[model samples]
Target: MKNNWQLYVLILPAVIYFIVFNYFPLYGIQIAFKDYKAASGIAGSAWVGLKHFENFFNAYYFKRLLSNTLLLNVFNLLWSFPIPLILAIFLNQIKSPKRKRFIQTSIYVPYFISTVVLAGMLYIFLSPTSGIFNIMRTSLGMKAVDYMSEAAAFRTIYIISGVWQTAGWGTILYMASLAGVDTSLYEAAEIDGASIWQKIRYIDLPSLVSVAMMVFILDCGKLLSSNTDKALVMQTAGNIPTSDIIGVYVYNVGLGSGQFSYTAAIGLFVNLINFILIMSVNKLSKKVTDVGLF
Candidate 1:
C-alpha cells in the first residue's frame, strides 16, 4: 500500500469529483419530502411526506408523460440501437483504410453538433415553405408538409436524427472489439473460402455479444428519460401531444413554474425508476448471457 501511494494520488481527483458533484448534492433530496420554500429554505421547510408524489401520480398529465417518455425512448432504442452495430461490422470489412477513415469521420462529425444546433437545423431543413425537403416534395407534385409541427412525426424525426448524430460515435466500442480479433481468424476463414457475411456472422457478431449486452443494459436505465434539450427546442403547439415528455414537463414545471418540491419529488421518482431498471436489466443480462456491467 505504501509503495502504491502514487497510484492512489492519481485516483484522488476522480474520487473527489464523485464526492463533490455526485454525492454532495444528495443532501438536497430531502426537499422532495418537504414543502420547500425559497424563504423557508430546505432546512426550515415543513415536511409533507408523500404528498408531492401522490399529486404527481394523480395529475392529469401523469399517464401522458409516462407514455410519451417510454414510447419515445423505446422507439429510439429499437431504431437506433442496431445501426452502429451494422455499421461497425461492415466497416470492419472495408479493406481501404482511406475510405474507412473518411466514412468514420463523416458520420462522427454530426455527434459533435450541439443539441440546440441540431434542433435548429431540423427546423430549417423541415420548414414547410422554404426547406429543401418540402421543396423536393412540392417539385414532385405533392403538397408540402410541416413535419416539425406534426405530432405523429415527432418520434420518427427524433429517432432518425438521433441515429444520424450518434450512431457512428456509438460504433467506437464495437470497432475496438472488432480490432482486437486475431488476424489469424480472418486468415483461416479466407482459406476456408468463407464469404464476408459468414465471417461477420460467425466471428464479428459473436465477439460483440458481451459489449452489446452491456450497452443494452445501460440503455434500459434511460427508458424514462428523453433528450430534454432536443425535445424542448423542437416542440411546437401542434406537436405538444407527443412532445410533452416527462423531462420537458419537469423542466417546465420545475423552473418555469417554480414548483420546487413537486418537481424534486418527480425527479427522485424518476431516478429511482432508472436505478431499478438498470439493476434489473444488469441481473437479467448476467443470467441470460453472462455479461453485465457490474
Candidate 2:
C-alpha cells in the first residue's frame, strides 16, 4: 500500500484535471433536461425531463442539421482519413534525412496558421472582386463567381481547407510508427527480390496498420464535430443552409440566441452519438488488430 501511494500521487494531477475539466462539466448535462434560466440558476431551474430533447428531435431544422452533419463526417472519413497515412508512407520512403525534415516542416506550417487567418486567406483567394481567382476568371473569359455565397461550394471549400490544414500535422504519428519498424524486414524483402510496391504492400502497410486504426478510431469519435471558429468564419447567411453543422448550430443557439438549455440538449445529443461511434470503432479495432484505447 505504501508503494502504491507514490503511483497514486503521480496520477493525482491527471485525476484533478479530469475532475475539473471533464467530470465537473458533466453535472451541467442536466441542463439538457431542464428549463435552465440564468436568473433561476442551475439549482433553481425547473426540471423539464426530456422536453428539450424532444423539441430538438421535432425541430424543423432537424433533418437538415442531421443531413449536413452526417455528410460532412462522411466526406471527412472518405477524403481526410487516408491523406496522412499516404503522406507518412511517401515521406518514409524518402532516403535523404535532410529532404524528409524539410518536407515535414513545410507541411506542418499550415497547421500552425490561425483558423481566422487561414479562412481570411481563402476568402481573399476566392474573392469575386479584385481577387486573383476572379482576375484569372475574367482573363479566361469566364464569369467571376462569388464562391462564399454559393451553397454548392461550401462543403468543397471546407473539406479542402481541412485537408491542407491537418494532413501534414496528422502524419507525425504515422511517421513515428514507421520509424519504429524493423529495418531487417525491408532488407529481407530486398533479398527476396520483392519489388518496392510489394515491400510496401506487405511490410510497410502491415507495420502501419495499428497506427492507422488508432487514428481512424479517434476521427470517428469526432464525427459530429466541426471547428466552430472555422465554420463561423466561412459561414454567411447565403452559405448557412449547407454549412450549418452541429457545432455551429450549438454556438448559434447558446451564444447567439441565448437558448442555453436548447443548445445544451443538442450538444449533448451530438456528444452521445460521438461516444457511441468511438465505442463501436474501438470494439471493431480491438477485434481486428488487438489495438484499442481501452
Candidate 3:
C-alpha cells in the first residue's frame, strides 16, 4: 500500500465521494421504518416499525409491479447481452482499421442520443397515421396498426431500442479485452489455414468469456432497477402494465403522492434484491469459471 501511495492518492476523491453521497445517505434508511413528516424531518419522524414494508408487500398492485420489473430485466438480458459480444467479434475481425473505426464510431452515435429524443423518434417511426412502419404497410396494401398501444409488443420495443442505444458501447469493452489476447494464437491458426469462424470460435470467444461474465454479473446486480427516464418517456396510458417498472413505481409513489416513508421502504427493498442478485451471481461465476469481481 505504501509503495503505491501516489496511485492511492489518485483514487481518494472517488472513495470519499462514494462514502459521502452513497454510504452517508443510508443513515436516512430509518425513515422507511418511520412515519416521516416533512416538517419533523427524518430524525424527528415517529418510528412505525415495519408498517410501510407490510403495506407495500400486501398492496393490491404488488404482484403486477414486481412482475413487470422482472419481465423487463429478463427480456432485456436475454436479447441485449449477447449482441455486443457478437458485434465486438465482428468489429475485431475487420482487417481494414479505418473502416472498422468508422463503423464503431457510427454505432456509438445512437448511444449519446437523449432518451427523450429517442422515445419521440420511436413514436414517430411507429405512429399508425404517418409512421414509417405504417407507410411501408400501406405500400403493401396492408392496414396500419398502432404499435405503441400493443402491450404485447411493448417489451420487445423497449428491449430492442435499449440494445440499439447501448450495445455499441458495450462492444467497445469486449473489443478492448479481445485486443489483449496473444497474437501468437491467431498466427498459429493462420499457419493451419484456419477459417475466420474457426479462429473466432477457438480464440476470440474463449478470451471474451471472463470479461463477458463480469459484465453479465454487473448487469444482474441491477435487475431490480429500470431506468426511470427512458421508461417514463416511452410510456403511455395504454402500456401501463408493461412499462411501469419498480423505479417508475417508486418515483410515482414517492414524489407524486408524497409518501416519503413508504417510498423509502420500497427503495430499501429494491436495494436488498439488487444486493442478493449480485452476491448470488458472483458465487455462481466462481463455481462455474473460477472467476468473479471479488
| Highest-TM-score candidate | 1
For residues 1-294, could you state the per-residue lDDT of candidate 3 as single tens digits? 999999999999999999999999989999999999989988898999999999999999899989999989988998789999999999989999999999999999999999999999999999999999999999999999888988777889999999999999889889999999999999999999999999999999999999999999999998888878998888888888788887888889899999989999999999999999999999999999987999
Give the TM-score ranking, best first.
1, 3, 2
What TM-score does model 3 achieve against the real structure? 0.97
Candidate 1 residue-wise lDDT, 1-294, digit = tens: 699999999999999999999999999999999999999989999999999999999999999999999999999999788899999998999999999999999989999999999999999999999999999999999999999999999999999999999999999999999999999999999999999899999899999999999999989999988899999999999999999999999999999999999999999999899999999999999999999998
Q: Model 2: residues >4 Å from true position, as ranges? A: 1-11
lDDT of candidate 2 over 1-294, digit per residue (tens)? 686999999999999999999999998989888999999999899999999899989999998988988898789788899999999999988999999999999999999999999999999999999779899999999999999889889999999999999999999999999999999999998999998789889988988888899889998998888778888899988888989887888888889899999999998899999999999999999998898988
Candidate 3, superposed: residue stretches over 4 Å from native: 1-4
Clashing pairs in 3: none
lDDT of residue 286 for candidate 2: 98
Ranking by lDDT: 1, 3, 2
Candidates 1 and 3, the one with greater lDDT = 1
Candidate 1 residue 226 C-alpha distance from true site, Å? 1.0
- Tally clashes: model 2: 0
Model 1, which residues run further than 4 Å from truth? none
Give model 2 RMSD, 1 decimal.
Answer: 1.7
